[model samples]
Target: MARGKEQPARRGGGGRAIGRVIPWAVIGLWVAAVAVLAPFAAGLDKVKSDKVVDYLPSGAESTTVAALEEKLPGGGVNDFVVVYYRAAGITADDRTTAERHLAVLDRKYPGPPTDSAPPSIPAGENGPHTVGADGDKTTGSSSRVQDSRDGKALLFAHSVGTASGEPSAYLPALRKLLEDRPAGLEAKVTGPGAIEGDIDAVFDGIDAKLMITTVIVVTVLLILIYRSPVLWLLPLLAVGCAALISMAAVHLLAKNFGVVVNEQSAAVLVILVFGVGTDYALLIVARYREVLQTEADTNRAMSVALRSAGPAIIASAGTVAAGLLCLLAADLNSTSGLGPVGAVGVACALIAMLTLFPALLLVLGRWVFWPKVPKVLPAGVTGAVAGQARWDRLGAWIDRRKGLAAFGSVVFLGAVALGLLGGPGSLRSQDQFVKTPESVSGFTLVTRHFPHIGGQPITVIAPTAKKDAVLEAAEAVKGVSQVVPGRSGAEYAEITVFPKDAPDSPAERRTLKALRAAVDKVEPAAAVGGPSAQNLDTATTSARDEKIVIPLVLVVITLILGALLRAVAAPVVLILTVVVSFAAAIGASTLVFEHIFGFKGIDPGLPLLGFLFLVALGVDYNIFLMHRAREESLLHGTRRGILGSLSATGGVITSAGVVLAATFAVLATLPLVPMAELGFLVAFGVLLDTLLVRSILVPAVGLRLGSRLWWPSALGRHTDPEDADGQASVPIGRERALRN
Candidate 1:
């Protein structure tokens, strides 16, 4: 009999050994994969394309111009302005030094070397231009050095050959050459080329900075939530692995599938991985801790925990992935590319948290909780018996005043949402940066000195046969200051039109519109493009994308929620609550932006990106609560189940919310206006959803509706005896009682 018993015990031990081996094997494989792909992942930034045209809508006028311009004589032209200023009035010496510097630039960085003979010039017109040492003559289309009306400043236009295909590559050397100045004269390079360099410089080192800040923020929050020196490291380590995997995957996708990754998308990807990964880890860990209070065996506890929390985690990830994927429908290439990049990050985080996180916890066992170690309960004791009486009382209070709580919550959110009406208008390119760069300062100096000249001229392309007609119409437009004819290709000619207003001013936008209308009437095939035109087109496209994409995102998320909840009423209510939460957050942010922070105006893409993140991510907390409540309702009935789920999930979900909010808040520390605005809106929105919407409004509504909250689901039809009696269906003191 002893031999027989030992044989059975040995067989059982072998079975358990296999279970232990599987998790380690999975972890080891992931580690090896990460090591193999780490190099490629590190090179992702090397492959990113930040071309201006890359971000615009494919069919936009600006995009068409960019493509056509590349096919011109020297491939294209990189145009910039060198402004020389003196508060005492520009002196002769200033002009001499500026001319000498221009000559040096011409010799060193000659424009496209002409292959064909100079075109014959018409009589009385500027004679056929001679190729200067700069490679192209300063033609009628080029603005040569001219004194400002005030005599305080002089501006000269410089063009370089774009045949090399990297206009920005020449900026650093040009900026350096211009840095040596003559006394009493200040020279600054401003225009598209210089501005592009400044923007690229801002994005430089952004990836490393973003990673450090996000990691620090997440680490701090995890320490606070876990309160365990050791426990926090587990999720942090898991999330870090997820980030690495995500980067590698994104790199591969971009390299193989031509996915676009810019500074914005890359930064957002890191935050998503850490934020969403930590959230999934929290849910799993919380459930595991609860299970540990009953099932002393660590493996058994995790098994039960995963089974309980897996559906919510999986469903939440699915919803986020689906919502982000909807961005593919966006007309803006940058916005569309963000969809896949962000979705990949979220998917990686989910896989790591569900697999690596659980495996690590099992391997480390209950001791990982350290000083706050959970203990197996005594026979009659329960999981919630230790210190949750506050949550119980809070639940009871809300249950009693359901109507008051619901009404009060709605009123508060609605009032905050009214601030949307006072928000400033669309943001312009000049206002895109949080802090002024050298190029912007230079542009401002030009505006002060040359009050009549636009910062960047509007470029128009018309049929070569109608060149004179196009120029005449452009010059006759209301706001036009001058029109200069440029190079002519096979069938088209380029004209540079200077407007009276500043490049990004409201007056300038109107001028561009008027110019377009006038030019189109004279030359039907003409196209208008330039820095200002690009900005206008971007804003217009963003607005159109908002109208189309917002409704689609809503439909997608609603269908997802409906499937996950298995109840039409519950999904509708959740969607409405999240939408209200989003509106309230945007409204509150608009006030902060306009009055407190003094932002110029909102980015045109703000509403769409804000809605995409707020609604999809906002509903995550609701999903956690409702999924748990639905499970409880099967056992305890709807009202009791709602209270029980809130009590059980309240702390963990709040912790998750804080983690996510803090992660996004990292973007506020960046120097870009759009990123900062997006950060604040999403962060504040999440907090509102977590603390007020999920905790107060959602619970109150669930209590008020009772079983009807679940409409058509089996839980809606099932009612416990205690629910009918208007008593607590299950005692709230302990997890066992709450579940019972």
Candidate 2:
């Protein structure tokens, strides 16, 4: 008998040793993965493109113009204006200096060589400079230089071949050429090339700046939430690993599959990884802490924690990933690309938190909690009683006034939602920068000095046979200042229509609308496109995508909730509450945007992108609540279950919310207007959902419905409230202890 007992004891010890080895093995594997991926991840920013055509809908007229322009004689071009300004007037010396600058530009970057070029290329295409019959460069007649009506601005139209490479490369040289301006003359390079350069300069620091800000925000919030210096660092380190892995995945996808990534998408990726990953970490750690208060073995406690919290974390990640993938259906390339990029970030976060985080916590054992470490309680003393008393009382209070709570919450949310009625309009290009860059300032100067001359002209493509009719109709449009015929291909002809108003002004949009209508009447095959047209298409497509994607996301999330909760009524109610929360968030954000922040209009894609993030992420808190409630309902029935789950999960979920909101809030610190607006809206919306909708409104609804909230499931049939309270009030591990 003694020999048999010894063998059994030895087997048990070996089993324990294997369990200890597993967690370290998992950590080692992840460390190796990160080491291998760090190099590729660092290169993700180098591949981002800021080209406008890259973001436009493939079917849009502007996109078509870009494609056709690429096939032209010089293989596409970058056209911009060199504006020489003087407060008083253009002096003789200014004119002389300008002529000399133009001559140097023509000689250095001359247009395509002409041997009386093909029909595809317009004649006299010796490039930006004029060439004599002898094939020699002419002096100063290369580019078309015009003087503003007020004589304070001198505008020179410069076009460079893009076949060579990115036109933005020429900006540095152009800036250098303009550096030696005449005294008292302000020479600003204001055009597509210059604007692109400024935008690129800002994007150069996006990854580092966004990462530092996000890490700082998350660390501060974590320290406050955990109140344990050591505990907070674990989640931050895990999230950093997730971010690195996410960046590598995105880079690989972009390289292998031609995925489009812009600076905006890349920055948002870092925020999502840190925010969502930390939220998952909080949920797991909270459960682990609770288990530690009852279980003696650290490994057993971790196993129990993972078992309880794993489903909720997975479900939360699923809803967000599915909702983001819906962006693939979007017509806008930038919005579509963001869908995969964000989905990858969320997926990587989930993987890291689920595997790496739990492994780390288990490896560190009970001491990870430090000074506040939970001590295993004595027999019959449950962990649930003291920790959940406050939540229990609040749940009881809301249950008593369920009717009032429901009505009051709706009234308040609806009142806040009225702010959407103001119609903030669409964001214009001039307002795209938070603080105006030099390109914008130069454009402004040009507008002031050249009031009669159009800055960026509207480009129209028509069938070659209908060129004259297209030109006549275009010129006859109300706000058109001039119609200049451009190069004609075999099938199509390009015409540049200069508008009387500024390029992105409301008046110009109207003018573009009228011009399209008129040109289409005479030349049915004609298409009008330019900077203004691109903006119009973006707004229209965004509105359409909102209608389609919102309904799909609601349906998808509802199914996920229903499947997870195993109850139809609860899922329906949860969906309804989240929708209301989204509306309230938008309404509240709109008020702050217009009244407090002084924003005139929002980005065209803001409503759709904001809705996607708010609804998907907002539903996460509800999932955390309802998932735990469902588990408790199995033993405690629906009423007590709701109260118990809320009490238990309240602190952690709230901490998670604040962490997420703070991470998103970091976007406001960036100089980009769209990012700032998105950050504010998402951050505000998340807070509203956390503080009001999830905490009060959802609980109130659940209380009023009671067991009926679990309809179509056995839990819906009310059980003895006294029996459930007596049994479930015991800490989870205590029942097993009593049995032992």
Candidate 3:
């Protein structure tokens, strides 16, 4: 302990002021802030929108079409198909039961007019209408019911005015009605409308579900790590405050600034705040405990820990926030919105951990550590010297076998990266759910029975004057099975075009392109959009976002690392390793998704999101290591400094990594496949980085580079006795681990 420098900190000068007065004031201020902000935080879900158009790329044709649809009569309508199936055949009794259900539906919700574009027709109160018929001649001018040629399925199309309500509100009631049927007969309501409803159902209460799961996961992990009854609560409480502040900030941004907040972004915000906030808490507490081993006064010890660990925490948060903000450049609204949403979360977490968290610990003092309370050690002893023998030996072994360790790690990561060869294509909407919902089952039945025109209808908006020409042009397109004219506004008319293949199919994608080309030639102002078109645009925009946002994130991280380390080569090496780590993680995840989980493909936006998280977060461990090494190097030169820093930071960094990875893994508990895929990849990547890259590869590489790792800095050019062979003079195993 340096009495000369820390004497005032131990006395009643600044130390007493911080210990006695500031902590209560900080805690008081946080209490008031939470009271004022809690309602806004709770109101976050009110502003969250998962609408397709809300997340579509700005200026895309689909977005334009969506805007135009809102201006038309009935504000556009929800289209769906009701499929009835029987394995053997539709017997007389089965047909009778289907007719009864249809009649009930028709009477409850009457269609427009027989002449107008009515949604569907149910069997009537009129004379016994023929049941197993094909086409529009089923006793009503408003509806069309088609029986499959194989006599196994009956399919019907319907539309509901969006002005009436969202599909999410009404589809469940309709499905419930269909639930009561004869044995061996199956009924499913599915199409664009039902699919939308199913997706909505998944996100309905996601905020609450995600928050509860993440908090429980973090709480359990913290309790296990601390092994103290009381110590874990302070960090959990601080994280709760951070989450409240973050939700309020995001809600305000969405309400006032029009920043898009979707279910996915909101859910991710909760996980990120809890995970990253706890990580900062772990690092701060570890340093505080170490300082407490030598300093008698808790406040003074915390002051020292803050001074030592604060810069690394701030650098890490800044790097993550910067990388996330790079998504602002993306064309996809969802991707761009996530950038700020996640940044706000990181900022709130940083502030809460640095402020309220430290204040809570200081106010509670040494008693909080309980049974294993930190007692002051002898004058020269520190916590690291008394513990962490394994870390010391591991650092020494890596230091000695630098060449072999670095080469082996690179080879291992490269081999894992080879899993990318088994390509998983972009995910379809039908495949979005981990469990097959009723809508997906119905869609499959529809496709099986109606092969020619089974896909969701693509809506095209064209000038009313050119509607006829546009319809004719669309019908000429190769994949167009049918083109029906929908309602007409004063200037524009809607046209529904059905493709022969299923939605999200390659054939359907081709059909969309051809339809767009044909309609554009007839009416230059026309735009093509629907559920299928939205999917296509979303995939296209996500790919474009990857190209722009990913490189920007890399550049931002590199700059931050360069400034933090005050070196060129070290930052570059860290960036390269994180990038390779991301690749390997994604590749490994792809294999799992394909073979184990039976996922058809990954979400289009996943690549950008995963890369941003892994690269920024993977470098976080390296920043802690290299930052400490930089301080140590100024005294002992690079070789000994890195070895000492590795041993010093190894346990705390690994714990932080596990805490972060576990928090992200909570997302896998959700039903959405995208969330699960993202959760698994990030969790796996963080473990790989913590267990392999940070523990061995980075330290090994640093040793081989020696002083040159800090090139252009004075630390790099300095020569010490240990610089002769770029090895530590005394083996780390024989000495006490370096003091904090």
Best candidate (score: lDDT)? 3
Best by TM-score: 3
Q: What is candidate 3's CA lDDT for residue 444?
A: 88
lDDT of 1 by residue, 1-740 (tens): 01122222223687778778877987897789889988978988877888778788877888878777777667667677788889898887887777777777777776644542221111112234333442233333232456666778777767776754565577778878877777777888877777777777778899999999999999998898888878999899999999998999999999999999888899899988999999999999999998788776677677778888998898899888888999999998888989999999999999999898898888877889988899988754766733357667878999889999999999999999999988888887767788997778888887787675654778888888998999999989998776766777887777778787877778889999999899889977889999899889889999888888888888988888888778888998999999999989999999998898889899878888999999989889999999999877766678778898988988889889999999999988788888999999999999999999999999998888877787776555444544534533332233233333
Per-residue CA lDDT of model 2 for 469-516, tens digit only, reads 999988889988767777667777778788888777788889988998
Q: Any idea what lDDT model 1 has?
A: 0.81
Clashes of each: 0, 2, 0
Q: Sort the candidates on TM-score, descending order.
A: 3, 1, 2
Q: Model 2: residues >4 Å from true position, as ranges? A: 1-11, 109-143, 163-168, 384-390, 463-466, 489-492, 521-526, 719-740
Candidates' C-alpha lDDT: 0.81, 0.79, 0.83
Ranking by lDDT: 3, 1, 2
Tally clashes: model 1: 0
| TM-score for each of the candidates | 0.91, 0.90, 0.93
Better of 1 and 2 by lDDT: 1
The better candidate by TM-score, 1 or 3, is 3
